[model samples]
Target: MPSKIPDVVAPGTLARGEQPVIPVPGDLVIRPWVLADAGAVYKAFQDPLLQRWHARVADSESEARGWIEEWRASWADEHNAYWAIAAAGSDEVVGRIALKSVVLADGQAEVAYWTMPEARRRGVASRALTALAGWAFDEVGLHRLELTHSTANEASCRVALRNGFATEGTKRSAGPHEDGWHDMHLHARIKGDGPTALV
Candidate 1:
């Protein structure tokens, strides 16, 4: 075990400090979730499309609050990082984004996101992803960031591409949705990949 490279990102890199609010283009800020956002979280899960792909719905505001608590705990544990995508100076959540399954030693993590119905088609996903990717690469020293979405989700594919995450390949039945297991399109971006912008 000693004959290996050191951790690309130090262990305390994230857990040692509070998750900072990240400002993205389009007047949106990615910030930590609060209990007050429970209603919005519940409503988001009720969206048919969200439920279709994510395969779970918040049964009550209390459950949504629990989800928020879990998100906060994830940051403390340094296993995952989640943020609420909201308008600047507003608490209303327009979307959500996260660096999932973070592996500090490997300098890699999976990205996941979703936008509210009102926030769709407004570049929220792309802009938020760009900001998150920047933070992961520049601030956290992560080397590789992966994005995977159902092959059938054209919108998500476009978001990935717009953020400079190149199409790596497809994973057969890699994601479970309300409909069933679905093939997934895997996209990835590595550090020094060059500027990330809307394509």
Candidate 2:
């Protein structure tokens, strides 16, 4: 039988005004961000936890819109895919995820994400990742998806593990924080990992 899986996603296939909603279960939906989400995005970044992990400080709505524009440009450049994690029935930006450092030739990419304080502990990140990983593998024809987080972030560590990513090892002094550099842990899920299944 012919393969039903989609072939490699063509680079530059995702352009501005062309947001694709990755199919995944649950009440969540992933959508392309809009400038109107700037306020929510700005508020999420105000969390000290988020700011510490990302080393980003966008204290103003204007700066948040700038961040959204950068995300739009990433799609146009075909280097990254960033999505606003929102409720299925609403447009509020409760979280965000990104497939960064895309290499279509190598069929690899790095995945990263953060949830607003209200969105945590609700499986938001995990479901978002499961959806993104499935799209990256089943639809985008990616071979490998990588995730890295500071060793100190227990929440992200759990999210990675729950999303079919296996711990590879630690990158020493690879993470920066307000205090100083910290150790970083690497995890990865291959194309055949199969939907974050429980063993």
Candidate 3:
């Protein structure tokens, strides 16, 4: 028989800012999603800057609500895990971090993230990514986690590089994003028994 998958089931909070959200720094908290977060997610995705990089476009309020509804449902499933990024003092969501599709055959998983336009350039994404990746590797026992970002997004590339995710290669026409085709830079890191730092 096989063992169970590791998760952050322990009762410690991931900190951010002065207030308690996740105890993570940089005024942000990366924690599991809840029904209360739906409104925040919808509002954050409405930002023009975020919509530019996201794969799906939400032109109407109902569409955004529907997306959040789906995300909420998916988060409840074991195969898909999601963490809402929120301001430490308030429940207002600033972004999200996720680990999905844990493939047992290859022992691999895909990582994804996003942040509000106002939250940019504050080391929020980098720190949150490192913390989340560390937790995933340590708790989930995933051998390797992969991430892909548009080549044009320099900020995202820096975050991946800072998190110790080495670039494997580029995928031509990998994503149907702006500018017809987007060159996605693939990055990955390995999990081990001992401790390590991505920064």
Candidate 4:
């Protein structure tokens, strides 16, 4: 027997137009990244942990600026949706998140994020993740949001689970990092997994 294809709004068609500021509880804000945020992003990239997990080092403001440009290009192409996490009522960016490798035809997207070194342990990632997941499911009409992190990265795993993403399994040696290959843990949140705030 063959599995029937899911009835979805279809991938690549969800992000149709203008992006807006998304407010989450706890005075957290998520908005599209801009060139003005380059400085903060560069500062974050200086964190050893960030560079370790992301496997990219930014030695100068110019190099970090390229990362921002790449993100902007991705947004324009609709290949990814990136955001800067900031304090509510402020333009200062403190962290980042994205609905990447989006497949609107399948009504699915992947969630990824990293908090500024100074912002860690403050629930920045969790709040941003929750707010974004809800928006993706309810407004963007996505059915599933996938999240993958290194098995050794328990903090990220906790963030995923805290946001209603259930662990499905692990992929052996799926991700390469500064140290070596890491087994990737996969988690996902489907529509209705939990409450999501549209705002």
Best TM-score among the predictions, by candidate number: 1
Q: How much does candidate 1 score in TM-score?
A: 0.96
Error of 3 at 133 (Å): 0.7
The 10 consecutive residues of candidate 3 with the worst lDDT sum are 11-20
Encode model 3's per-residue lDDT on 41-112: one tens digit a residue. 667767877877886766656666676666656643445566778777786777788777855445577888
Please, what are the lDDT tens digits per residue for candidate 2 over residues 12-36? 5555346687644677888888889
- For all predicted structures, in order, the TM-scores are 0.96, 0.90, 0.78, 0.90
Instruction: List the global CA lDDT of all models.
Output: 0.91, 0.85, 0.69, 0.84
Candidate 3 deviant stretches above 4 angstroms: 1-23, 192-199
Which 10-residue window of candidate 4 scores lowest in summed lDDT?
7-16
Cα error, candidate 2, residue 4 (Å): 26
- Once superposed on the true structure, which residue ranges of model 1 sit more than 4 Å away at CA? none
Residue pairs whose backbone atoms clash in candidate 3: 14-22, 14-23, 14-24, 15-22, 15-23, 15-24, 16-23, 16-24
lDDT tens digits, residues 57-110, model 1? 799999999999999899988889999999996667999999999998889999
List pairs with backbone clashes in candidate 1: none
- Specify the highest-lDDT model's number: 1
RMSD of each: 1.2, 4.7, 6.0, 3.3
Residue 64's lDDT within candidate 2 is: 96
